[model samples]
Target: MRTLDSLILDQISGGADAGSLTTADTILVCDDPTGDLTAAACGSGRRVVVLDSDYSRCQRAISLGAQIAGDRRLDEFLAGSNGSAVAVGEMPKSLSRLDYLARSIAGAGFDTVTCVFGANNKHLARSMNETLATSFEEVSASRGRGKFRCLVATGPRNVTYEPAAGDGLVAVGGVFSGARADHGGELLRSALPAQLGRFLDLGCGNGSVSRGLDGDITATDSDADAVLSARAIGLSTTWDDAGSRFPAGTFDTIALNPPFHAGTTVDATLVSSLLDASARLLAPGGCLYLVHNSHLRYRPEVERRLGSVEQVARNQRYTVLRATAR
Candidate 1:
């Protein structure tokens, strides 16, 4: 929780200490990427569960000693709860989660739900308000501090998720930046080796790389939304942190369009992790088809992992590289 997050506890959750837990209480904390506030809300006698899209975030929840489902969605997790649930959540930045959260709360048989939010994201604020209007009979808000706000709602109403369009891509409530084209991804897909056999789509989003590709294509992503979207398209999908889900030397080739950001901060190290993972996952003589911003200087680093990294294709914004595992 940042200072704004602290405001959430102070204003919405009564400083995170007002509730008395019972064995019968089922508490859900949603989108708990950091796990700090969610862990604090997990009292002694109640069952608490967390929902997070990111594998690292879910791992953080486990490390903080909170239980979460393998599916990590609210509806999926709450279906198993024996009693009615109460929930506290951070505001979602996208319409996907907001829509899903509303439907899930209704499906979960929740008695009450509150979301702590900052108005910095107008789209999120609007979606949250819309979801609340449809999902709850009574909804109220707390006074704001700086850009922060809170909404308390009860009673359930029906909600339908966003519709499919264009490529029939339906992002599963957790895809970052939505299920759209990534120039790097498109470039990498175009530049894939024609001799492909068993392959992995690392950081797969909506199976964009594996779609229409021949052979045994396995797709993996850290985002639950991306895996769900990939699976929706009939791809064999796995939730992964980098390429750790598979054994060493598992694939004949890998397609990587490495992410450079975690949250909003740009971090160049993500490409290194992807390259290392690609190396570990590729058999000898296997190939890595990688794409990134043209100025990223990934060649030197990529060469360190797989030998003879060659320049494949380059445009004004992107550069594609091919690496052969030694």
Candidate 2:
């Protein structure tokens, strides 16, 4: 178990009140990719319902005997749990995501629900306590253990659910770049060819790249929240892993602003997998427009996988590359 997970489990299980894990009949887990929390919750002989926005994490939780909140918004799933449940998980890195979770849990109309979320001390913020206080009547923090700390919130206050508002996009918390397009995404969007035949926005967070594009445009993201955000803006999107659900030679033009972070850790494999997928999905003579931090230098990989590559645009922070399939 991660240090944060262990701390959270100890804090909730050690308590003897109604908020104790032993007293609660239902436990809702959020974003537990390792399944450690889900397994521990299930082992306590309570009904475990997991709400993970990431598709891969949802599958992992299901394999651990935790029920998944399929096609249900956070508030909807929490509402079905009858309000007398304990919610636990790792604290999200984004303050907006934390606020969303706190609000959703508070608005679930639970007669009594206590939320226990832990994270590395480095990731914890004073704003998180303030965010939770907006929804719960009482909020407290546990002592640091192995550089991890748990925040406990109880007494849900009645609040209405509201979708997260973005600059021009309707986004859920934790989606990449939130409601606004990042510099890399904007660079790639501007570098796109004038006449894109069939466009595939790979790893399309909030459909920023495909926004306002005409003719056979589709978006796909691994995060369910991202897919929801894209769909809300009238973009056709699929909740998929690197466009794996589509067949080879499916698109004539592909736009990518790949994610480099998996939670707090930088994982280069994410970008590599998308590169391979884009190469496979593009038709003969198809074009790919990708933007990334200049330090990543994806030129060699793009050349190896997708044939010819050229730097189409670059600024201080980002570089846009265009590659053509052989």
Candidate 3:
């Protein structure tokens, strides 16, 4: 088992008491993108309600035999809920978003919140623990094991958030690059065809590319927060992981900067999924424009999914590819 998984199993197996989940407990699991923990905890006793701003993660949680509470809405689920909140995966890198998550968990009336995070994200751990400490009456932590940690906080909930404007989107976090455009996004934008017709921004983060262009464009991302941010910037956005809402052959071009990590772990499946989705969405002779780290070998995947691939641009760190649909 993975180190984090083993540690979590140990915690859960030890018992569901002393700030841990107990029989028939209503528990909120946060940031569980993979739904592994939700599935494990769904066996008995606890009623697992998973919350994630990422729409795909929410769907995955539901597929694991856990019912969708609040229609898989993270913000709505966090408000005035009656469950003990627990986070068993990575934390957002954005401090403001982390603060919002912690404050929300505290305010949800959870008497016990247990979080297990990779020790590598010390800043995230420190911030969350501090937030819990300030919001609750008691907080304690386990010694870091193989760069993993479990923190248990219990007591009366005393959390409050000053309602902010714009939902303080950037402040609310979970979007890629945390409110700013990423370098790959900028490179992909610079390489866009001068004139465009129907196109897509697959895996769009804040819809940066589509927001800058004027044309028949659709932006799709798995993250609801990203879709919200994209719409706020006047870009047409859809919250879907695989662009399922759009019919096939619906676009002339697709631009992407697919994320390749699950937390700190580098996983290339996300890149492959984006390439396949772009291939399925493009009309014959349509083009796919994408950017990725120079080290990742996506050329083979592009050739397999789309058609002949051409290097459009390359920097010291990023390589942009143009693949035409056969």
Candidate 4:
């Protein structure tokens, strides 16, 4: 178990000992990437349900002896729990995601519910408590242990989800750029050719890069939240990792704004793997438009994987490169 997971379990056990959490209540483990909490909760002879957006994580939870709610949406799961569910998980890094989670839990028609979310101290913020307070009547922080602490929220208040309006981009929380155009995505979009055939928006976050584009466009992302956001805006989307599900030479044009971070850790290999995937997926003589931070220096990698590379656009923060498959 991760250190943060241990801390969260300690907090949950403390709550149960204090009579706030009962075994009769179903424990909803939300987005537990490690599956430790889900397994532990099930082992304690408690009714446990897992609420995770990622299909892979849900499978892990199931293997750990936890039941999954249909569709994996928090609201639907809590509604069936009959007001006797307590949620536990690691707090999301995105404040918008945290707020969305708190609201969904609070609005499940439950008169009362408790949520325990833990994370490293560096990841936790005062705004998290404020965000939870918007949905729950009470929000408090636990004492720090091993550089980790859990946020506790109780007394669910009546709240409803209000989708953000304007900008035509409909993104759920945790999706990159969140209902707005990311600067890197905008750069790649502008660099795209006016005419495209069999276009693929690789790593499409919220489908922003494919918006307003002509021809047969398909968007794909590894993150379930991102796929949901992209589909919300009427784009054809697939939840895939690095275009791995598609056959080679499937796309004539590919647009990529690959993610550089995997949960607070900057991993340059993610970009490299995406570059390789894009190269393999592009048809011979097809073009790829990729945007990244100016400092990543990906031109050589693109040239080695694809063919000749050209700088299409560049600003202080980002560089857009175009490479045609050989």
Candidate 5:
């Protein structure tokens, strides 16, 4: 049998390394297990914690003929053995693997945790490292397999993540200290109306939006993993395909940081659909707040659907739009 390093490196073009493998390490891996790197990492004998946002992937890992471990079953399996674990498919789709991994450790009561993502999840890696650096003793980054790697070490000492000045959205309460909205919790705190009664937080990553709200707020996401994350954070959430069945006129407020891509491809259909959904879901006089990268062409859709849209705030890279339901 081939060593894990050789196998991973060969497939990822020397991007994989065994040197980072440390002893007794509880590493969180949020990657496609079908991918070679995960297999290599698993073979290396590290205490692998598998986390995939996809329910299918989670189910596959738990079945009899599985190759990867489950996320939810990790604590049970890791009770005595030094072998790897799969966290099952309980992670949220809105959260990148890193966020899912962080929330997993926070909930699982692990002293320290590290995360590794494939090239496809680089954006997630960056956000994770930047936001959750202090929670883990060490927050490190590496490049491999056309992806980025994030390693975080956690312990009793509380670490915090802060988005830099001018980043627009700020980190809010209960985010860094193992709260439901640690990563983008502030997005919820900011976008949510103070007197929110029935609302919807679209693309609620890690359930921050729902957690920030006082009463019932419907959380929705196309990513099953994200929906799971919202639920994990105790948010009443719904998962949909973005093609059918969104709660219509069932909310007073709607919010989103719409996704920019679909599996690394520039797919705007999700965002466009969100705009339409927001308009349809909001009661008359209801409001929709959206934060997005400045360059994305969302204004047209928002205007077409809502009759009018206004910019609430603007920065170099991001814009916050608040549109009213006519």
Candidate 6:
């Protein structure tokens, strides 16, 4: 039931020093889906470099004017420890990335270490606290802010980050992790058929729909962070869609709410590929179900491939499309 504004309000607030942020060069260590923070920061006149695990997030970051921070490798970023403060709207998953970042910082040096993890990232916080307690200067946590948490670790000190601002942006529950499923889940549940043999939710952000499906289903996205985030909640079987590779005609049903924006602009490539992939993945007589903004030009592409496409339903802002595999 949360609108975009409501979710954004409940999840993200003003970052630190909106003005004081040195316009100097900065590198953001984040996954692809969350790389928007790097782009936004870069727009503030800072020479930004983005380090991501997935190539897509890196490409999007550079497209937004962020310099390539040395390909999307965790070790690459962690090895040098630019010591410059990094920023994110939310935290990445627990893995060598956190450990590497901490080690790099300890070696390279930094003044302030500010981490904004999604409120839903308790496991991530726990992991960092358990593994890097002595490495960071200070470590602090806050709650109920959805998928965003602001942690400030000062010279090996553990301190909890306080709420920056409250306009209902801060949720009641402390930091929580999972896909931001509030609105997308409802849309998928409403648009999809009740009975399906096999399902594939493309760009399955947090696996919101795949998790709800009754039978066999596969969830996928180009964003590893999204796939990782969804899988952390038990929705597995994600593939990197960068190369657009998948077993042909392997799915009986496919669904998506496809992302509209990657970095800062409307990306038609993602939509175009989703359609092509749907056509390639669906078996004969299989169905492709999708929801997208009403204004996007998806009909022509759908018809081009499927030879038949129809609008199942529509509202002022969104449209649901259905097509059968030939």
Top TM-score model: 2
Q: Which digits, one per residue and each the tens of the lDDT, describe model 6 over residues 172-249?
A: 111122324545445655788888777888777555666646788777776544555455556654546722556888
Question: Residue 143 CA error for candidate 5 (Å)?
Answer: 19
Q: After superposing candidate 1, which stretches have Cα over 4 Å from the reference?
A: 15-24, 63-65, 80-84, 117-127, 137-141, 145-147, 160-166, 177-179
C-alpha TM-scores of all predictions:
0.85, 0.93, 0.79, 0.88, 0.48, 0.53
Which stretches in model 6 have alpha-carbon errors above 4 Å?
A: 1-51, 55-179, 182-185, 242-245
lDDT of 1 by residue, 1-326 (tens): 56545654565445344464322256666765556657666644556677667788778777767787645555665652345555666776676776666666665655445444433433235557766777667666767666666776666664444433346555667575456666777888888878788899998877776787778889998877788778887888898798797999999989988787765567888777778899999999999999899877888998888888888888899999999999
lDDT per residue for candidate 3 within 1-326, as digits (tens), equals: 46665565565445555644443256556555456666676754577776566666777777776765422334546676664555554455555555555666667765566554433435445667776577566666756667676665556466765422242223124566655677888899999997767989998876666666877878888776677667666777788876888898999989988998876678978787778789889999999998999899999989988779999999989999999999
Predicted candidate 5: what Cα RMSD to the true structure? 9.2
- 314 Cα displacement, candidate 6 (Å): 2.0
- Candidate 4's residue-wise lDDT over 1-326, tens digit each? 89888887777676465533354367878768788888888787778887666656776777878887523345554653464667889998888778767887788875457899998888888999999999999999998887889999998888876544349898676777889998888888888998889999998888888987778989888776787778888898887567788999999999999998879888778788788899889999999999999998788889899879999899999999999999
Candidates' C-alpha lDDT: 0.71, 0.84, 0.69, 0.81, 0.51, 0.56
**Best first by lDDT, ranked:** 2, 4, 1, 3, 6, 5
lDDT of 4 at 207: 88
lDDT of 5 by residue, 200-287 (tens): 8876655654564677677766545456445655677665544235656788877776667665477877687667778778889888
* Candidate 6 similarity to native, TM-score: 0.53
Predictions: Cα RMSD each:
3.2, 2.3, 4.0, 2.9, 9.2, 11.9
Alpha carbon deviation, residue 122, candidate 4 (Å): 3.0
Query: How many steric clashes between backbone atoms does each model show?
Result: 0, 1, 0, 0, 23, 29
Displacement of residue 23 (Cα, Å) in model 5 is 30
Runs off by more than 4 Å, candidate 3: 1-3, 9-24, 53-57, 69-73, 83-97, 109-128, 131-137, 143-147, 155-171, 265-269
Candidate 5, residue 132: lDDT: 46
